[model samples]
Target: MKISRWLVAVIVLMSVSMTASAEYLETKVNFSERLSSSAETLVVLVPADTQELSLSGWSNETAAQINRAMQVREFTGAAKQQLEVIAPMGLSVDRLVLVGVGTPSDLTRIEAEEIGAALANHVNSTKAATVHVDTSLVSDVAENGRISASIAHGVDLRNYRFDRFKSEPEPRPSQSYEWLVVSNSAAEAYYADLQGLANGVFLARELVNLPGSTGYPAAFAEMARAALEPLGIEVTILGPEQVRELGMGSLYGVSQGSQHKAHLLVAHWKGSDDQPIALVGKGNTFDTGGYNLKTSSASILAMTTDKAGAAAVVGTVAALAAERAPINVVAVAPLSHNLISGEAQLPGDVVTAGDGSTIEVANTDAEGRLILADGIWYAREHFNPRVIADIATLTGAKVGALGTEYSAIFSEQEDIIRTLRTAGENTSELVWQLPLGPYRNVTSSRIADRRNTGSPGAQAGALFLQHFAGDTPWVHIDMAGNALIPSASGIHPEGATGYGVRLLTEWVKIYSAE
Candidate 1:
């Protein structure tokens, strides 16, 4: 389903307010200025207060000199015991919270997030309005910005509470965070990107967190179209008949089980006449596992999140448009619901796809790949894209292989793999490249066309989908590992993580130029 422009605006505003409310205080070791604007509260950072502690010289100090000094017994002793003595000076606030940054040379983005989260927790607990961070020690602009963004993203995502329907939301404690990057111009430049990324992340969270009844396939498509159309995105939605006319039998066959009609929605942003980068998503609005059926109540109930892949694509497009990224991108979503009914495609049934390739339906639970096959074929045939990437909760095998930390990427094109891997790493939505070659034991299928499932112990379903990609420079992301969160992480909340949106947007920005 599409998100409306009005709703997108509202969500963006709320996200900005929510993110701005968390106060983060950054400071140097030797700076002696006041830490808080108000006399009633102050949060401080000290070396001894945290788990690990160390120091590095900022600015004029050489890396070698800093490293050498860190090894000195006198310096080490001073650093280890520094915070304990400094804690009493800042008594203006109700509580003085101290966070330690270990060995400034080893300061990383993850460390910054840890510091930010600790500070946010303190402010949240105390109900402070503003946070004053002193960045007098940070010397690297890019590194500092990244660390700051990570901290803000983490705090914002964790603090997200979907209390829209509650009447008492106003009484809940909320804190606003502002970072004072004294000498970092790069941090200022990256602030806009951070804001946009936060907006996209929040959009994905809201979309996935909504109940299935309110977020049906048609409604999702409408919302997306409304959000993009005003920004000059060309939007089109093909109904079941239209899909049938285009011979999308695989997608059509899957939708037969559901009461909601299927939709193949496409949104295009042609910033230039360059070869488009195709983004496809498996938009299973809801899945009851069709004819095979789901035995576990948890699995069946969690089917509401099946459309997370589609939501990511929609969020990507919205963000690209919002940022005015100069790239040609086309997003295709094959939306449907898999339910049990007499009309549902049974096991062993073969359906021809848009490319006229027959797929043997081995298991209805593996239906995500079927619809995505249609989308990939459609994108290839219609747009002749230079690179094609399809995102989906295609398999639990991915989660088993990569766990919940990263998305599994399967691709035959090394360059596309490299591009995606770099983008994923930069955004912290990491992708671990999985083998896509035909393994002799799992490659042989006895039934029609190809088997969706490989051997019993086969752990690479993302690679399995590569068989249907034809000659396209395609990458399949098994978002099963990253799409929905049992809990919040980074900038994603308890629902949809919006795993691929930022990576895809960044990749496209680099792709179009090439």
Candidate 2:
């Protein structure tokens, strides 16, 4: 094995060369130098309802070519509509996708989310492997970052498919493409955080979309443990014995009918020891309406999604843990299913809630309020929260009144109400405050402390939950209207829409800073 000095030097140099090639420049995110730089597709966002076509990044000659193609295709830059051109002149990008923003200058976070979603849908349809977003139209890096992050979020949401039950599902095209938010300005950290938030949203959607047998109370507690406990959030799965010891009779009464034992999942993210913000949710995994059985068939079909409130809380708290939001947050998810059996609580049955408020069950179908009653009480009594926001799909009346447009929020505390409204507006998961002051008296029971439900009124549901809030600045979010998606739109796919995760996360982020 006699090697020459030149060969030995060459071998060492060759080893160094390989190592250098293996180790590429590391960054949180990578941006291309230009929009057309080695990109399979370049997307341009233009204002809708305008006669003039405005593609910001393109040159005058290139813009005229795009405009001419747009005119030929009868494209008016309408929202949700995209004009695609292949191999346009003066651009290295393979395809151009033009998405219309309703008004460019008046663009908000909601529009940005939709635009991001629109881009994802176009990419999937056109089968573009690599895509780049042109941020030239937007003025500042902050706005650009927001838009880019939103786009990342939209793509994350669109990628979700609940195909667990499909034994012979169609094979999807492998999405091996690198989705880069190519920009010259701003760091990609904000967009990266949005993707982290997306993980929480996806978790909520997964919980809500699961079959009742798989997503039942005990199963859900484990799901929360797997998702949250890893992130350093202290998760306590309270069993039937612990629930009984705490005297959560209202929750137990509604849930005992099912063979699946009830559980109260308590997730504590104690980033700060200061009085925590508490979030409570009604976790009705499935609702058979107990002794007071469901009168409508549609009600039975939608019962699996009864735990959407719990999912939202879990999602939000998990996001806070993942993002490491610098504040203490206590999330209480009370899990149960309203099923009919020999042990089922009948109408007129009375039980004391966790806060020791005796409640008369007027309709056994109003189990969400009963379960939530205990969860809210627990949050208040234990956490001693600065503010309590209790969320539930407590009433069909909310859906009837709001019609999938808004989640009806009822709060007497103007400050709490305003904070939630701001959060909703920021996330486009809108919340409209209805009356809670006058409606509170209507929920009072003659024999017991209060009735579980009142004439199926939307305001009555909030009023019923309010009894358990106990002097804490309380906001009851009746999310019945916004729980399910009729079809794919915005960041929501055609299934259980992850509603309150964004709203609560945003609210907590703002609330924590203040």
Top candidate by lDDT: 2
Structural similarity to truth (TM-score) of each candidate: 0.78, 0.86
What lDDT does each candidate get? 0.65, 0.75
Residue 398's lDDT within candidate 1 is 75
Best by TM-score: 2
Residue 473 shift from truth in candidate 2, angstroms: 1.1
Q: Please identify model 2 stretches exceeding 4 Å from their true place.
A: 1-31, 34-39, 45-64, 70-81, 89-94, 100-106, 136-139, 172-187
Q: Estimate, for each residue in 131-216, the C-alpha lDDT of model 1 and write its tens digit.
A: 54444344455555555555565565455555555577534335545555533455555555655555555555566666666566
Cα displacement (angstroms), candidate 2, residue 382, comes to 0.9
Compute the lDDT of residue 485 as modeled in candidate 1.
68
What is the lDDT, from 0 to 100, of the residue 236 in candidate 2?
93
* Model 2 C-alpha lDDT per residue in residues 1-514, reported as the tens digit of each score: 1334543443343223222211111111244435334667777655566566555445787878888887887777665567888898888888987776554456676767776676666677765556666655544556555655665566656656655467985444234333333354452667556655777777788788877877888777876776677678899989887898999998888878888868899999998888899999889999888887887998788887899999999989878877777889989999997788888788999998887779999989888888988999999898889999988887778888787778988888877777888998999888888776655477878999999777548777887887788788888998885778768887776888878899999988777676
What does the lDDT read for residue 52 in candidate 2?
Answer: 61
- Each prediction's RMSD over C-alphas, in Å, is 6.8, 10.4
